[model samples]
Target: MMKKNRLERNSNSYQKQSNVKEVWRRLRKNKGAMVGLVMLVIMAAVLIAAPLFVSYSSAVGQDFSLVLAKPSKEHIFGNDGYGRDIFARIIYGGRTSIGIALLATAASCIVGTILGAMAGYFGRTVDNVIMRSLDIFMSVPDILFTMAVVYALGASFFNLIVALTLAYFTNYVRLVRSEVLTLSEQDYVEASTAGGATSMRIILSHIIPNSIGVIIVNTTMNVAKIILYESTLSFLGLGMPSPQPEWGQMLSESREFMRNAPHLMIFPALAIVITACSINLVGDGLRDSLDPHLKS
Candidate 1:
């Protein structure tokens, strides 16, 4: 009997592993997603090793002789109006842009998830209060609200992140709340509740695990949106300060020289586009993979 049980457990484990492999196989078959994944990997590698290849000061340093230089062997993406190496700046700037997007997304997800889970699991007064407040926040224009927050708080890295998090958290709250509402009706959730599990315990153990798929998909897509919003804010002079090597700040500084040195604008713009597209592609793949109906 013991031997038979061991065999059955082993078989179940193998089956579960095979299912995961199959899901990956399906994801790999998506050409666009795969391409985007590859592009993202390359960009990430470049950004990570940027400092190793070029010092931070050198990237932002000014040299009148190199100002507005065209792409060449010495400077691959050439120099900007400040005579800073565009290639070096791009590599460094990617760190700021990608880092801010990820940090802001994580903050939004954490705050949103907690509030959304509480509202959805409890319902009634809790739901009404949380959802009503979120509704009021959603009513405001996202950009305008972000600008106001940043303006009031004083624009800095921390303030920028807080502003973006506040603006973006509403979507996650709504998404997670709806998911939790549906998940709370599942048999296991009811079983946990009936078994005398504490509300927090049931929410953390039973409710959250089941609702994770939708949450993950939403979080993935939100990264792209956050990056774009960060860039927009930076362009409007409310994002990370100048000389910080942020993509948006680079674009903002280059606007006046657009007629003279279009490469300055083109490279940073291309970086943002590629990053956003890659994230969106990955999000789409995750969505398809997580959908039960789409699973073969």
Candidate 2:
């Protein structure tokens, strides 16, 4: 019996590994997804290694002589009005922008997942209460609501993250709740419940795991949305404060010099566009990979 159980466990593990490999194979077949993955990896590496090559002080320091200097061998991206290295600032700014997006996405996912699971598993009063709350949040225009929160809370990194998370988390709650509602009706979930498992246990052990595919895809896509929202807030002066290397803040600072110093705006805008596109492509690939119908 023990030997047979061990063999069964090994077989199940092998099957799980094979399933993962198949998903990777399908994801790799997507050209856009591959390109996006490469781009994101490159950007992440650059951001991680930036501080090693460029000092933080120099990236944010002022040099009156180098102010508004055009792109050259010394300053590949040219100097900003404050004479800080635009290239360095971009590298550093990527850290802040990407960090905020990732952190906010994670926060939303956690909060949304628990609430969605509870609502879906419990139904009735719990479902109505949670759904109604989410509806109220969804009723507000995201940008306007985010702006109001930021303005009210005052602009800071934590507040900005909170604002963005509050504005964006509704999607995850709704998505996860829908997924859970469907998953709860599956045979396995019914079996678990019949086996004397509590609602929490069934929701956590069976329903959530089964519903993870859509949750993953949605979470991946939401990263890009969070980045854009962060940028908008920073551009509107409701994001990170000055002296911090944030891409949106950089763009906001360069608006006055756009005509003569177009590079100031060009680089940051390109970064945002490329990052968002890459993330979206990745999300698409994940959606395809996780779709049972598309699996080979």
Q: Scored by CA lDDT, what does every candidate get? A: 0.89, 0.90
TM-scores of the models, in the order given: 0.93, 0.96
Best lDDT among the predictions, by candidate number? 2
Positional deviation of residue 14's Cα in model 2 after best superposition, in angstroms:
3.2
Best by TM-score: 2
Model 1: CA > 4 A from native? 1-19
Question: For model 2, what is the C-alpha lDDT against the true structure?
Answer: 0.90
TM-score of 2: 0.96
What 10-residue stretch in candidate 2 is worst by lDDT? 203-212
- In model 1, residue pairs whose N, Cα or C atoms come closer than 3 Å (at least 3 residues apart or on different chains), thus clashing, are none
Task: Specify the poorest-scoring 10-residue window by lDDT in model 1.
Answer: 15-24
Candidate 2, residue 82: Cα displacement in angstroms equals 0.9
